[model samples]
Structures are given as C-alpha cells and as structure tokens.
Target: GPGAPAWAYAARRHWAALSPPLTGWMGHADPFAFAPEWQPAPGVRRLLVGTPPILAMTALAAGVASFDGIDIAAAEAKSAALVSVFAALVAARCPGVGVDAPPQPRHGAQLVVRHPHGRRVMAALIECGVIGDFRPPDRMRFGFPALYTRFVDLWDAVDVLAGVIDTGAWQDARFDRLGKVS
Candidate 1:
C-alpha cells in the first residue's frame, strides 16, 4: 500500500530503522569490515543467535578452542523435541492456555495462557514452586530447559497448575494484588 512508510520497507529487508530521508551512513556496510581493530579482547564468547554451522565456522575462523552456550546440533534437536512435549502437555491439560509459538528450545518452550486473573494465576504457580515469567494484564510464559528439565517436571507442573485453577486458589485477593513487576 502506498500509505505504508519507507521504514516498513527497511524492516522487511531486516535493516535498522532510520528517520525519513535515509543517509548513506545508515548501516549500509558491515561495521566490522570498516573497523577490524574493534574486535573485542580475546576471552570466552557466546552468541545467542545464528545457525549451528555458521557459529561453528565463525568459531573455527576465530581460532576459538572452547565456547559455552552454543548448542550442538544433536542437543538442539533433542531439546526442541522436549520443548514440544512440554508445550503439548500444557495445552492439553490446561484450559485457556496455549503454546506461544512453534515448540522450539532456542530458550526452551514458552507457554501462553489467558486468565482473567493472570497475575494471580502466576503468583499462585510461583508459590507452588513452579517459576515462570509473566507479563502485565495476562501472559504467562513457562520455560522448560532441555538440559535440566525432566518429563516428570512437566507432569508435576501441570498437576500443580491444574490444582491451582481447580481450587480457585488463584482468586485469592493476595494473589491478585500486584507486586513490583507483577
């Protein structure tokens, strides 16, 4: 649509947004190429994104002997499977709850559930010793790390959550009350 602005096009091309009337200095080139000397002092390094093959190639090119946090191909695949299972379980057993996205373990599975008392639901879960991040109004995100999480953990979490909902424990005024970020 002609009504769309120029920044929309920039976003589609995965370029950084800039004000109207783009300048030549707006990320047109790789900054690293322009300033090779800006490489950080050698130390332990990690990258949260990029394909395994690409990350491996970069590590080899940089002569990195060891790196932490980057998942091996097999491990990532396995973790993704685990995340799928957890998401599926949550979706099946919990009403008004659904997985946030395709079940992937990039950072573990994120489950999204809708509750009128979203904050209270989250607070109750936390009190039950099941920790998950929450957003205002109504968004609860639970992460199941493949490396440390067990199938039983998922089963137990769902059991606890179902109890909370069924018992209406989340309706407690104390739970409904906001806390710092909650």
Candidate 2:
C-alpha cells in the first residue's frame, strides 16, 4: 500500500491511436539522442510521462509480487465477509451508528458508517489503534483490504468503536478540534 503504482491499460489495437496527455523524455523513443522532434517509444512506454522513481517502482514490484499464486476471487469474498461481520457487529453493539453502503456483493472493500459525532468518534477510535478516517458532515470510513486485514482485526475495531460510543469517550475535547487534513 505504501508504494502502490498508478497504472493504465489500453488494448493493443488502440495503442497506436492513443496519445499521452503528458510528454516527457522518458516516453521518447531515444531520450539520449537529442532528437529535434518528439518520437514516442513503442507500445505503452509512450504513455510514461517522467523518469521512473526507482525506489518506488522497486517497492511496487515487490508489492505486486506478493500477490503471486493468490486467489483474487477468494480475497474478494473474504473482504465482503469481513465487511458484513463488521457491519453486523456495529449494528448490535454500537447504537446510533449506521452503515452507509449497499448490501454485500454490491458494496466495495470498505465500510462507511454515519454518526452524529462521527469526526470525534473516529478520532477516539484512532487513538485506540483502530485507525479510520472521517469524511465531512457525518461519515467515517473503515477499510478492510482482505490481503492484509484479518477477521480478528474487524472484531477488535468494532469493539473499540462500541466502547468509545458507549462510554462517551469520544466526548473528549481533544477530539473536537479538527485537523487541517480530515
């Protein structure tokens, strides 16, 4: 997650017709030749805009490599299941908290919940090591990426959230002050 790469895909037939929004030396066919005009490199190389960040790319490569032999479908199912379990737990234990997503199979890999004091609640949760972010108005998002998140983590997070809400721990004045970045 720290070094995730941004990638784009185009069909082979459309490669010749496509034009890169940004043109940089790395995308040139022969960057060292000092050519008079731009000559795009063959295939997807033409889409590269700048010199690659070697360290970031290396990390990205390793991150991608870690997925080798993993079943993506199974991962998706596990993510959905984890989200479902989390939502159910929140409903049962955390009164006044409501999920803001569609049912399973329609929802993505995260759970967004709404609460009157969502921002402060999220801050308290973060303090308890259950990291989640709050969106404006009244939304808090918790991500459960199946590759890294385990089922026990979901239970722990929901438990912390319930404790924060039940004991009025989120009422701490420190949690009310908003950060520059939400």
Best by TM-score: 2
Instruction: Tally clashes: model 2.
Output: 0
Model 1 lDDT tens row, 75-100: 66656776677677777887876556
RMSD of each: 11.6, 3.1
Candidate 2 C-alpha lDDT tens digits along 21-49? 87778889998897989899998888876
Q: Which candidate should be chosen as best, given lDDT against the real structure? A: 2
Q: Where is model 2 poorest over a 10-residue stretch in terms of lDDT? A: 1-10
Query: TM-scores, in order shown?
Result: 0.55, 0.82
What is the alpha-carbon lDDT for the whole of candidate 2?
0.87
Candidate lDDT (C-alpha), each: 0.61, 0.87
